[model samples]
Target: MELDLFRWRFVHWQFMLTRPSNYTAGNIGGSVSGVKIAFLGNGSYAFTVTGNSNPDGSIYNSEEAITSQTTGRLYGAIFVRHWDSYITPQRQTIFYGSLKKDGSQYALSKVVNVLKGTNLESPVPQFGSTDNFDVSSSGIAFVSKDPVLQPAIFTKINAYFVPLTDFTVASPPSPIQIQTSGFNGQATSPVFSPDGKQLAFLRRKSVQYESDKLQLFVLTDVAEPNSTINALPTADQKGAWDRSPSSVFWSPDGKTLYLTAEEHGRVALFTLEPPSVTANSSSLPKKVFYDGAISSAYPLSNGDVFISGSNLVDNSIYFHYDSTSGKSNVLSSNAKNGTVFGLSRSQISEIWYPGAAEGTQIHAWVVKPSNFSATQKYPLAYLIHGGPQGSWEDSWSTRWNPAVFAEQGYVVVAPNPTGSTGYGQGLTDAIQGEWGGLPYEDIVLGFQYIEENLDYVDTSRAVELGASYGGYMTNWIQGHDLGRKFKALVTHDGVFSMVSQLASEEQWFPDHDLEGPYWKNPSSWLKWDPSAHTANWSTPHLIIHNELDYRLTIAEGLAAFNVLQQRGIESEFLSFPNENHWVLKPENSLLWHTAVLDFINKHVGLPTYSEQSSYAKQLRSEAWQNRKGDLGRKV
Candidate 1:
């Protein structure tokens, strides 16, 4: 049996198993020769394809071909049936079974009705490695919507266990419900301990709040039908500790659980040992590794661990961590030569400075030009990340890339301020409802610190750029005292008015992040409203808005541009009528970069190659011709 890599997303790898001899032998009958098995991300379902391999070793090319195949299967399928009035809601039935070849077709064996309900108020099952389910030799542990909760104001998710034996029998036994009493929030990523006595999972209070942090929990007596869940005490619960924790691995002794968590500005490794009930000892989680952001980790039988992570200067790289030496050795990387984005001489470094709040520290990434020199002053491009809850990770991004700015002879500084993840939960939670308070202060102070400390930086030639939440910050900065700090500003798909943003597609973001709905607290809505301070705007601005940006809505960008035009500020509006919140298409992205770089060059001096390079000349000519054509048509 050979397992071939099918698809990879984030840290999860989906595989397809193939039996080479079975295809040619035609043991399964008909045109279909082999069984192709595929597993979903969260193991919610497993699909099988029973089809013939072509000359090129590919199968199931079309819908007709798939239907004509010898067999097909869908495990753990949920069926919904609607009845009565349209508002009465629908009934759901979950089915689980194995597929077997049955006379030129396929049949489900040991078919089991795992769950059935009318008006089941539960979250849709998340089929991935991080979100919902895991399977072991003993049983299958999964996170499912709690059917008991009604009205579904906030869907409550709970952990469930079904014995492996139940699937083999004609009638499956009722799944054992692992009660999460104290922690009645959402639960996910259930991983059984090596001894099978305890199960570890991540719990969040509510789904309404985007900033809600996931805490680690270990359920004792997991074998019992009713087990008690205890929150594992960690050294830094306040810091977004264990925020988005996944890929749980247990030590060989079953005494310690190792997992990857976001801390400060990186996704590092941490370990937690369940406290003893008799001794009442403190069993806090401790940081075991601090190299960079770890995407995935797997423990080996020999006590060593394999990890895939990236630092401030590199992309995804594989490494082996030695348990005894406490050292990590590089195994492989896409850019093993230490070059990134084909820029061999560029450098990246993490810079820490005193945060806006006294005694607090802020972190940011600084990308220097490939030909950086201390004697000459360089223009700075201060990049802000979206997701006031998101971070400037030690990873590479094609969109909003700092390296591109660096390649253009500009030093880039991306700060992970308050509310950014990977830091402790406390810092992440501090920015909620105070969007323009601590987080804004952090960004301003971060720039001030960089300006004061970095003598090679030309603060007067700086340009501030951001998208999404970062765009919101850029809007806020344009109206605040910090607006005078930068020579030019760029806001893309950002929120302009807090109250108007309530009309966004995602209602939960404003409901929780902004404290509540506009009706509930009208005054709070005006606190971060950039429209209210348009009188103070004086900076040259470039506004980018997309038609399909339902998250922040195109209206928000329109409102900001209206203010810029009304205030007579030197501004330009770049609208992507065909794109969404993000400009993803190749041609559109190229146009975006060209326009943005042109705007920056217009304010700050152009790079040395801008006038000489044929590509730059062609891009400028194309832009000019398009603008002239638009003006001519209007006349």
Candidate 2:
């Protein structure tokens, strides 16, 4: 969409020469593929395209092979499969074309590959998008993982500056590397200044540890002439900063930088001057605003910052903050969160309980049902967050949402344990080599704190659930004392074995978390292995695994389910073959929720899913049949 800033509206709405059916919508599935990125700049346009077809629009023969007849994958390298899909000859790449005029609308002409001659992939696989690349008037800067490194065990992604010479160059000029002073991690979130003179990005020190602190850097003299095409341009790094920034962008004046980092379970916005301005000041980076999670903060030319964010109750909110006046004006929000959905800020709160470690306080979000009453006890729905490095932030989510579960007549307590981010880096780093030790104790202590203090929460009738790392914790709980406390457990895309987890595509993850290879350090992996305690597994379990979850793989969940069955423990297996790590489709999400809720409801002695729905239906049916009499009696 091209906007006319002067008029504060759109001039030409359609940018595509030929409108594609759908890039991401579930409906209208025929003759469609996804458009990952569509960038318009410098009289040329670029896009990241994904499909089974070639440049000539010819479908690949390998993709058309008969799967039922004969099939086998023979490969010699790591990352043969990453994230969701198996390795294919074709990978998603950036394509560029001339910005042509289609009547009154601006559109892209027939395009050519940007990384044609290079052994690089843009919009980095699995979890990257428009932010992975930035376009300016002179060139395009993008971050791609080390082409020669073993992606399974190493993580080093560098930002490349492509000085554009032509839109249809068969092989574009060799892209130069924007060096980050020997940083060995992904140089992500590269953002070009408004004038295209400078590029700011974020990088880390450790390649293997994905959760390492992201240091901010700015590359100056970006448009300087270079005789050597792929020359390395040194970037200025911010070393004194303690917190890792997730997003980075230049201020409107181009003298300062704005960043957002997770702080105390909140994504706070911060502003810092460039090193050249004044580097040694203790107050270099100052916190701006962080009531809820600030997803985006755009500095206006007039000094006000436009921001968008959400909290536990509100789904979405937009506001503009004027630092001069120190005031925030609400532009828009999901007012319907309360008016239509009957949700309120009062229903959600926070509790900081002592963790297993002395002086270690773990934060948790406590959500009560809309009609909660202190006189009555409510079943506890304890939610564990994934990422171990990830925290249950003050934000809204579509999946594993605490609000949705609370609305279903339960009190949701989602805890951010020892390893959770947004807290100090020390707590997060402490989880290293002790994934199942201290963090597990933090979770246990968190529950114990609730049981002993939260009077209205019935911990005995609780359902503990989580996905990914949280899933791994639930699996760990199944073989421990905490499993006995919950009525049932739900584990989604979780790891069941420590040794078997090395089979995952990203070996660097288990490598770092477990400290080393299982063969080299057996105790490091074995001491925390969920499989080691299978002899103690007696809890009712709902295991959910997807076929495309290459992180943990389906084997983990299947192994857990088989163990449950062999032990004659009450368990059910839920599989989504079409989905990946998450249930994306609407219908699939509905099924996922139903299966999970039904299993938990059954174990907790609450009404089953169908029973709850049927009872509600019966009430409506009886009221409908006697509407006239009911109205007359009421009158």
Candidate 3:
């Protein structure tokens, strides 16, 4: 059924693109006359079918349709803006935009501000809409700021609602705050039940040591005019913290709620069942879908769902999950098309290995060479991800593509060890204040596991590479006994010293990860500081740093190179003066990749320079000059 719908939609889109003469100019400025299909948060869809010019020179909507085919209903449009101008100070606000439908034609109301003269500061209010607003059926209840209270006492932004009927006049009514007893952090992503009697939202708490922990709450009796908006008691489950929950959606029956969160290294679907009683419940949220991290999900009236996410091999694809059969079917192409860029024929697989502790499992992604054979050995390129709290999701990346390594005849392994998100919050928080502890051990064990299990992987000819947190890990690896494990190491924009890294622009990162300032926890700084262990470093290294990287600072990379050079250890530094922490420009990226590949090839016995690809040779020359005459040394 979804396949047919997709085909029809594809045909319609193609037809709309071909027939340029049929589209008339819209009042909204751009050419928006074509049928633009937009999915609403209420599990339904809307489209601007056709447009026609009115007799008075103004354009009138010839056809504007909303689908009532789903279990959800459409509310009036809500427009939100981050108003930062001379007239209004920097503040985030939502406006009510009424919808008037006449036959197939509909008109949108002029936006009326929901909050007027409200001095709300940072940690702004969210209307549960990144794309479309999460509004009640009557278009009255919407998520906004609690305007009655100033941001001084309540430093955290709280979620509130304003009814549509309150905007009969020019001035809008004050929003009613949803009260959560223990939660004082910002509230966002409010999802109203289909019956419009209950509201579900996430409440987060600001902690000094780590990220804000989010807990799901449902407000009952929301329809009552003078109801005391108390959230139902929820369980405080450890390791259940949400890692980037983007959207909140309720089932058609309103008994179940679905959301996607990073759990143990993938974005998996979680289901929460609101307790029947108001008392604190011990029912924990269960993970329903485990295939991959679901970026977005849209539920249908017939208990089925449409999801978009990435897996081990493929990047982004659409799937339809049948609730009855408990199975999912692909609805989109297996791989993206139309790109002529010669990508390698690589196969990706998810591998689980023993972690730092016994019986503990760590997840890693392996990308093998195109013509892979068990009889032939291949060098390994270990790629680490950033975020310390981030995971190597089964997603495609242009910057650190593992396939590119495979194209060079090297097997690539990307791991989401301890402290990586998508596993569980407990695992993510494990490395807090212990950056070089369990996570490092996990990476070592992951590599050892691959060496022992994969016969085709030549671990002795391996190179470890990473950027950001991964860079820090590479630096950390250089200082530990693991330095002897790899033939070479590459660090890009990595942290060299804990105390020096404190000079980073984002103080919150070190503050949260290190458990406070360096002065406050000098022991923590000394324990894992890579600079402190430079005496143990012996491996050949390549250091890459960007001048615009204020996060780790250019000094971090320079310091690492200085130590290696001062000690007479084989080392090279490549500086990108015009780039940031990431080399984003196309030409710069080509140079970066060429330099990295050259370094890897020199160590792994591959052709250091490819004459067949003149473009690559030219990039290698440019990158060598950027090395500041250091290319003469044995790489």
Candidate 4:
């Protein structure tokens, strides 16, 4: 077999937005034969044609981009999904190319560039931040910047028609207008109907900071924007800024539009009939369905719906019927091992993955006490997710610290609430900008559901814990809803004040999040700041943050801690000296988990859980043996 190096510069390994970079292999199948590895940069990578096997034990007789960098740097790069890759002579980078299982090459007509001096001003870290183009199986339609249109949010968020064949963008493309002056909110999820004739999207015309309200707009076009179009605000739903739609998806037939909205912090599903190509604004909006506290809803190919709910015991995704059974089934109930056990049968509590809420189809693991018994209910620790848009899946981690708490008799429950991905795009965008609102309610309701439904859980001994966005929610609970309900709260790398997060990292504000900077709308910042209710905090809190975290800097954590202390509230602050946003080193992770278990135990009156396990003891013993010669003499 002949092997081919994917690129001339193996050292410059590039990561794709959707897949891993096995540059050693020219294609997605595996390493090719006759390829030799060569170092392009001080051995950061190796371009070779040899019989090198991957982690799966398959011989990879091809080139490889192995990391020769330090763990801190390597892990950091992988964390951000940036890798080395070749830059084309056209000055085009892989960032514009699409790679799929089948070899096919397609490029964007023009890359979306963040205007200089804009929020996307910061250069990507040592590892680049830009993602290589991703080709969707079905073609896509986007709104692009045209000097004439001058879309308010961008020069353009182009609506290039990506053809499924060869996955190429159509030439002389048709474009749409996404942003215009006086728009309250940014444009979100542009979805075309199944027939590709109608389009639906959620737009915020304006965002009010104090009340956290947004003006919603829905535009429809029968053919293309170039043709006659019917664009206007939706009158089907109330026009209140406080209750704007978050996610919009079209049915397979293009007859229905599914939307998720937050009402008093609870999410509900609403189906409406969007205006047709021939119909004008005269069509009335009708709600075909409704579910209070619906976390997420996904549309499947067959028209069945997969809904990941926020209700307890109902966290799993449910398959709703259009023609099939009216009820949904739980997919997570199929996993056999609820808790992972180590070599000695001692439960490795941290190894547990969570399942979806009880009735939904999604699945996640729960870490429970090694010595726990049904007779003695345990205090529950709810591990909140950060991305608020990310999912809690079954995977291994060295830092989650679940086992440490489980060993101490704490029932650790991590839920894949609404807004988590892997379910579908509709579910993923359900909580945009509605922070401290429905997003917050889903979590609280989840905890309540677990306490009421799970026989092994004790409501009186519950705690709320999370990092980053999860951290933000933990702090929110301390001041808004669960201040008195939760026995203790633990926030890691979370935001206390949105104003500070936006101001501290101004360069990141525009592109990644925030329609504009804090200065443009300072009230939005003040309204969402958890510290605004600091005077109301009653639960003891433990604030953990990394000194070097660029996302949520230590200063943010310190400010919140200081205010809590000043108010005579019970709070403690702990900072990682050399770590970043996520504490990755295994030893450091052990320490972090141990400290969390200790803190929660102290507050909840549970017995202390030792951080040390048999694995730790064995590692220490090996270390001592290696250092025996330095002892000078045996004791």
Best by lDDT: 2
- Give candidate 4 regions above 4 Å deviation: 1-139, 143-174, 178-184, 207-223, 226-246, 260-270, 278-302, 305-325, 330-489, 494-502, 506-541, 558-591, 615-635
Native-to-model Cα distance after best TM-score fit, residue 16 in candidate 1, in Å = 12
List TM-scores for all candidates, in order: 0.77, 0.84, 0.75, 0.49
Record all residue pairs in model 2 with backbone atoms less than 3 Å apart, i.e. clashing.
none
- Residue 18, candidate 1: alpha-carbon lDDT: 34
Error of 1 at 209 (Å): 2.8
Q: Compose the digit string of candidate 4's lDDT tens values, residues 470-553.
A: 898888888886768888889998888876764333233332344446677666566667988887887888888887676666
Q: Which ten contiguous residues of candidate 3 have the minimum total lDDT?
A: 78-87
Candidate 4 displacement at residue 420 in angstroms = 16
* lDDT string, candidate 3, 1-635, tens digits: 01122234434544235343332211231112223333333323332212222322222332432334765434332111111111122243343333333333334334344455544321243222332234554333434434454322232546665554322245666566666666666566676677666776776655232245556766665754343232333255322444546467888887777877776556777666764334432456666777655778988898778898765445667889887777787788356421233433247677888888556689988888766887999999999899887888766666887877887899899999877776656676777877898889999888889889988899999999999999999999998988798988999899998888656644556777887677888888788888888999889898999987766778999999999998988887887888877898888887788778877788888766454468978877766666544546553
Deviation of model 4 at 512, angstroms? 16
Task: Tell me, by TM-score, which candidate is best.
Answer: 2
Model 4: weakest 10-residue lDDT segment is: 87-96
Q: Tell me the TM-score of model 1.
A: 0.77
TM-score of 2: 0.84
Model 3 local distance difference test score: 0.65
How many steric overlaps are in each model, in order? Answer: 12, 0, 9, 56
